[model samples]
Every structure is written in C-alpha cells, then in structure tokens.
Target: MLRSLSLLALIAASPVVAEGARELSAHEHGVGELNIAVAGSDLVIELHAPGADIVGFEHAAESDADKAAVEAALAVLGDLSSVIALPAAAECSVSAAEAELHIEGAHEDHDDHDEHEAHGHDDHHDDHKEHDDHKDHDDHAHEDHKDHDAHDHDEHDHAEEAGGHSEFEASYTLTCAAPDQIETLDFAYFGQFENARELHVQIASDAGAQAFDVERDAAALDVKGLF
Candidate 1:
C-alpha cells in the first residue's frame, strides 16, 4: 500500500512538472500579439494572452539612446519578484494606431468693435472736443446694450441646454494564439473620452483580467495624460 501511495504521488507530481515545462516554453516564445500607440508624449502598449500566463516580457527601443533608457526601465521592472525577463530575440510584432483628440467649447460671435472705433475718429476735434464726443458716443452706445446683453445670455443658455460636449474614440487590435487553441484571438482595446482630460477603455474577452498589468506600465510611462 505504501508503494502504491508513492506511485500516486509521483503521478500527481508529473503533471505539475509538465505544466511548468509548457509555461517555460511559452515564456521563451513570448506573446503572439503586441500593439502600441503614442498619445501626446506617452506610449501605450497592449499585450494579449490567448490561453497562457505571460511569464516574461522584452522590449527593444527604436534607437540606441532609447535602447539605454528602455534597458534601464526594464532593470527597474525586473527587480520586482512578480515579473519575469523575456528573451531578447523573442518573436513578437507591434503595430501602432493613430491617436485621436477632441475638444469642445461654446461658440460665440463678436462684433468688430475695432473697425467701428477706427472709423469713428474726427480729425477736426481738439483733445477736449474729442473727449466730449467720446462721452456722447458712450451715452448713445447704451441704447441697444440691454438687448445685445440679453441676446448673448440667451445664446449661452441655449448652449448649456444643448449639453454641448465632444467625444474621442480610438481602437487597436491584437492577434494572439495559445498552444492549446488552434486559432488566434483578436483582442481589442477601445478607448473612449468625453473630453481630452480622461479616458475609458473597453477590452474584449478575458482581457480585463490583465488591465492592471497594462495600467501599471501605462502609469509608469505617463500614458494616462494622453487622453
């Protein structure tokens, strides 16, 4: 009976080892899909896992100077126990999409007062006479001022009632496949914004599970201000 129990324990342990091996292999190959975008000065990267846990990550900068900075940043990330270093030659491709910006404000029309002032000057008047004429012009200007003020107020109220606002939308797709799955999954990150200030992302499938991971990197890269 002791021998049989030992055999069962060994069988149970075999699967664990096999799973670890598979995970290691996956890590070595890295992710199947990668997407990147630039908003403002921030860089946003989204990696997808079709069925495997992301055990490692590697990034190469486009330039030598950027490479040094990227390497330094990776070093800081590697210090964390939760992260695993990826192979430099891992097979991964990144595609970036253009970012969208939207701004909204109340529109108004203003009369050309400068032109009116320029034409109203009289060459024959002395300084005192000009001052008196200006006072008289000011007195007449008040005649329709109340109606113009009310018109502006009404336009502002209409703008407020209409709830004028702007919205921006951006979409990026990543194709990643798992060893167990025969087909690749198209993971999408759709970002929406009411203004240029804040962003909301809607992820497809189980992508939300990895939101924290992406958010952490985004924050570190200062991508939050891109929206």
Candidate 2:
C-alpha cells in the first residue's frame, strides 16, 4: 500500500493540479475532486466530495433515515469497482479501500463546550443559593430558567438557519499486473451518487501529469499513455 501523504505530495507536484488545488478546495455542492497517482505497478486514488452530493444532506446523522443514507453512501464508496473501472487488460485489483463521512459542527468540540456549560451552570446555581430567603431564591431561579430557555431557543433557530456542512472522503490503492495496458478510467461515481454532477480529476504518473474535468454526461478519463 502506498503512503497516502506521499502519494498526495507527488500528485501535488503537478503544476496544473497544484495551481487548481485552491479552487478545488472549495466545498461546492455537486462538485467532487479526484486525485490519481501511478507509481510502478501501484495506482492510488483519493476522492473528496461534499456530504450533500453523497447523502442528500450535510448535517449530522440525527434521524434514522439520515443514518441509513450515510451508511448506504459509505457502502457504495467503499466498493472500488462501483466508483471506477480500469481496463480489463490492466488486471487491477484494489488492495486497500477506505471511506468516511464528516460533519462540520460543535460535535468534535462537544467535550470543551460541555465543560464550559457545566462551569457556568455551577456558578449560576451558587449565585441563586446565596439568597437570604428560600422563596425569593426559587422565584429568581425560575425567571432565570425561563431566560435561559429563551436563549437556547434562539440559538437553536440560528443553528437551523445556518444548517450544517459535511463531506465524504474515500481512498483506494490498487495493484495492476500490467499498468501500461490501462487506456482509460471509467468513472461510474456520478451514476452511483445522483447528486454528484462534476468531477475534477488530477493524474500523476512517470510520463508526467495531466488534469481533466469530467461531467456526469461524460465520465471517462483518458489515460492512454500516461502510465
């Protein structure tokens, strides 16, 4: 298996891919990025796509339906043959495959946020406890509770409006018996993920580097002599 970082570093050396990397980094909906690197008899591919294009939603999987969609998408992504087909003469077989979904939100920082909230709650409780009269303390606490509830409701509304951003990433490493026999890479990714409409591909090989823009209508990357 090729080291992912090394493979990406070699691909990044391609001037076209390097220059366009910034534009490809944008999390544009319906657009996906693919990087291909061929070294000796090994071929490595990395795919990056917005969660919206993969699962129809870019938020955390909170509901059963959302979770199911994420699972299905991952399954499809993990299947290397479902995404790209190599020339049968090349005799390529996937040696490694990985796929994952990531949601951008407070989820990753939940522990820190929870700690802060707990500290603030303790402070508020102590302040209420210091009151001389028990009934006065109860009434004040009740009002404060209502205020907190209202604040939380406003936050929830804002979060809903902002929605959530997520993405899917997959990587594959394949070994080919006859790498030079590869004439093209037929992408079936667009058909598998209905929301994926465009694929920006970058290729790096001993022959040099090249780039191609593939649309759903034409999803083949010609690599007749690249290897």
Model 1 TM-score (2 dp): 0.19
Return the clash pairs for model 2, or none.
none
lDDT of each: 0.29, 0.73
As a whole number from 0 to 100, the lDDT of residue 2 in candidate 2 is 68
Positional deviation of residue 205's Cα in model 2 after best superposition, in angstroms: 1.8
lDDT for 140 in candidate 2 is 52
Query: Model 1, which residues run further than 4 Å from truth?
Result: 1-96, 101-161, 175-203, 206-227
Query: How many steric clashes does model 2 contain?
Result: 0
**What lDDT tens digits, residue by residue, belong to model 1 across residues 1-227?**
99999999999889877754321122212122333433322334433321111212222123666434433432322221112121223222223322211112223233532222222212111222445466544433443343333433544454344442221112232222221221222221211111111112222232222222223213122223122
> What's the TM-score of each model vs. the native?
0.19, 0.64
